[model samples]
Target: MTHPFDLSVVDRWSDERTFDVTPDAVHAYADAVGGPSPVFAVVPAMDLVFAVAETAAPADLRTRVVHGQQDLVLHKPLPVGEKVTVRAAVVGLHGKRSGTTATILVRTRDAVGDPLNEQYVTEFYRGVPTDLSVGVAAPRLPSEPPAGPPSAEAAHHLQHDLPSRYADASGDHNPIHLDDEVARAAGLPGVIVHGLASLAIAARTVLAAAGAEEARLARLSCRFTRPIAPGDTLTTRVWADGAGYRFDGLDGSGATVLGAGVAELRA
Candidate 1:
């Protein structure tokens, strides 16, 4: 029997999607991720990634997919009210021990073709088997905290209602995030927060610590080390690393939940 996910879709670019960035949308995204500074005139960077992925996902494998990982590189801050074009393509596909992984590349450019940002998103489909041979690589991180004391640290209390609010704002109504029964069926303790939501909070902390304009963020990358339950307190610690920073996020129990985090700020 053929797999539900069509692995043959790999390496094909989807049709281009045009988006008009609006102030209201930006504000709503900021509110969903806990507010960012008013100085940011662009939409939250991750919003673009999600928007493109919405159009890029394969129709055949929509329901049982989960976001596995993400890496974002921003060329510049996307200005509100500007028209941008997004294109997505499948860049990599691998068969892992647990499931199949599909890596999608989304690139956004200005109306005039100036590059704005690029994102690589990995999605996992549980129980879907693939014959495609590919290797799995683990994310690299420092075994211990950097030599010096952390440059910055902040604690964020993830409210119980955050998942619902994020789901509404992000258009990701995955039952695993909203329905307790659905989560338990999937072997989770209960409704867990979205990994992107946690990344947003971590990004906010990095932006604040660098004291650089939010628009100047050039790159953000992290590995989701653990699932975050609603109402958990997240503590982010950052250390200076050249023109950027290396960071890690810990849950209330001091377990590192987001690791191998790196953020680059434009000079």
Candidate 2:
């Protein structure tokens, strides 16, 4: 069962999309992720993911996709009302025993073409068989976490309504994050929070602990190790790692949900 979508056209660019980082959109994204600093002039980093999600993947490839991992590098803060052009390309495709993984590289720039941010989004299509002969396997994050007591920690409560709200705000209406039946069919215990939502909360916590502004967030990357149920309490733990920070997210029971988290803040 080869994948319905062609995987050989790597590096081919998709049609460019212009995203206006409006105040309303920024506020809505904040509200969706459970309010961060409400008065931020710089847009939330995950908004770039939302913008890419809107136009990155072809429709036929979206029906059964799951966000596997994400890497974001911000060159400059996206100010409200600025229109950024997003150009995406298929950077890599891999065939695994269970499915195919596709990597989308999204480059965001100012109207004058100054680089604003770069995002690498990985999506897994379960049960989509493909030829392993041609595709390369995506790199894996370390399963082991940093040792010692965390230098900083922050607890967050994911409200029961958050998934639906985030779905609306982020334009990610995957039923697995909203409909219980859909989740059950998909083998999830219940509707789960968006992985990017969890990442957002963790990133915000680290920035706050470092006494840094959201605009100072230069790089963030993480792997989702477990599903985050709506209404679960998440505790993010961070440790200083040279010029960057390594972190992880634990559920109420202390089980790791987001792992191998790394973030770099601008000086």
Cα RMSDs, all models: 4.0, 3.7
lDDT tens digits, residue span 173-199, model 2: 778998999888777888999888888
Highest-scoring model, lDDT: 2
How well is each residue in 70-131 modelled by candidate 1, as lDDT tens digits?
A: 67778877767888887776666677556777677777888899998877777776667666
Q: Cα deviation of 169 in candidate 2 (Å)?
A: 1.8
Top candidate (TM-score): 2
Q: What shift in Å separates residue 64 of candidate 2 from its native position after superposition?
A: 4.3
Global Cα lDDT for candidate 1: 0.72
Please give the lDDT score for candidate 2. 0.74
Q: State every prediction's TM-score relative to the real structure.
A: 0.83, 0.85
